[model samples]
Target: MKWDYLLFYRWLALNMVGFAILWVFHMNGMVEPVFLADSSYIVYVIAGLFLYGMVLCGFRVWKTSRELNWVKRGDKGKLKEFADKSRQSDRESVKEAFEIKLFARISFVKYISSSLVMLGLLGTVIGFIMVLTNIPANAVGDAAQVGKLVGALTNGMGVALYTTLVGAITNLWLNANYNMLRTGVVNLIAAILESADPQ
Candidate 1:
């Protein structure tokens, strides 16, 4: 498959399919929404951040794909243009662009992966705090009252669990994309070097 094709669109479809199905289940009441919005809407905020991270990664991928196309064309003149490090005056700098778009930042994939986990952990801790604050359910007052408390606690735990699951799955999803992106980048670099010095 072409790197340009897979770099942005295919994985976007995968994510849409995967997450849409999960959302359908959630909408149908087969699964919970992670946040009731009454207690803590932070889950939604984290999710939004995650989506933004994906966009950043997507931008980086799109930029890299452009460079990959340049490499595949095997344009010696362009390579010379780009490879010249000590250009006295040039507006478009290849080294600078490469560093920004490909090499250094990881497309924000690593950050998203780590941040997803942290967000999940934070949600879980908040859930635990919810349970802790309502600990009077275990105080052994009335049997019916205790049963209701247990149910409430169970629901709280469900929120924590679902958030954790979502975070993990999101990381896995992005990670798969990251691997493909890295492979494409490495290939592009090798192809550019080869094209630059065709022996």
Candidate 2:
């Protein structure tokens, strides 16, 4: 029933660092810069990174759980006994795992989602600014110039709306998947331990 304490800690550390970085980006005003930019591609890149980080967290959790000592032992009788105890221990550990709790805590999602929403709003604002500044000067100024400026604003608005949509969808997706996967892993470990216990 021995546990690999190091694996648990390492898993936790990685998750914490990832979430921390995500939070930092949000607090630092990612939305402002992305919105005011001349283009929307940078916003896409940032959003992609954020999504990747969430997926990475999930993989780390699953991999760490798989590497536990109890799970690796092959002797049925002994493995069961050990796995049962290890399951109990891991259950306790996972219960207290802050990294898991972070998924539940709205702070992480809120910060990330809010940043995304803000980024969208910023895009919208910039788009509005462009529209206002590019009025035709000639009987129609350069129709092309005004049209181009207006077009930029429309693009910005699209970016803003899409970013916010993505942020919201991702927050829900990440939280739901993480909970389901984590719960399933813990429950399976518990079952293995129970079945392995000597009757």
Candidate 3:
């Protein structure tokens, strides 16, 4: 079967385009407010985690593509080394081990992706707590305190909404990259196993 060895590179290019568009939106002041309004700073944390995930995804893609190329050129690369060192003649066991090795490399990306959403939830809880704790007992009767109370409520709401939005969006973005990298890994494993097969 013919394989597009450039698959991972193409996927990485798509991710870069998506990020470029996001950067354009950010530069035009479209997304800046949502980011800035989150006083809890959870949005910033989410962004950082997303960046880290992207880096890991890129690295995985590069490595997988290189290994696939090596296999395509009849090098067998790590698969050959593993089969030789382990002295395992069962193709199934070797395939399973190779799959595990590939997946293990990017496990941290999965964890970081999950943590993004959880942190957003943490921000939301903090926001609600801020809202509840800032309300003065006399807010209903005291006009002067009412203004301050309303301001506090708005701030809390901003934090809640902004963090949730950032978290969901970043998670989706990172997941897309993860899925692409995963597909590459699957293809790489298939290629390796096929090459290793004895005719």
TM-score of each: 0.75, 0.42, 0.90
Please report the TM-score between candidate 2 and the true structure. 0.42
The models' CA-based lDDT, in order, is 0.66, 0.53, 0.81
Q: Once superposed on the true structure, which residue ranges of model 2 sit more than 4 Å away at CA?
A: 1-38, 64-149, 185-199
Q: By the lDDT metric, which is better: model 1 or model 3?
A: 3
Model 3, span 123-165: residue lDDT tens: 8898999899888888979888989899889999889888887
Q: Model 2, 15-131: lDDT tens per residue?
A: 576568757977998646544553655357546745764656456455535534444554343335445555667655543453344334423433554455555556556555555
lDDT winner, 1 or 2: 1
Q: Write the residue-wise lDDT of candidate 1 on 36-140 in tens digits.
A: 622556567667877887777777677666666666765443355556642544424655574455556564687787788777777778777777777574456
- Model 2 C-alpha lDDT versus the unseen true structure: 0.53
Clash pairs of candidate 3?
none
Report RMSD (Å) for each prediction in the order shown: 4.6, 10.6, 2.4
**Which run of 10 residues does model 1 get worst, by summed lDDT?**
85-94
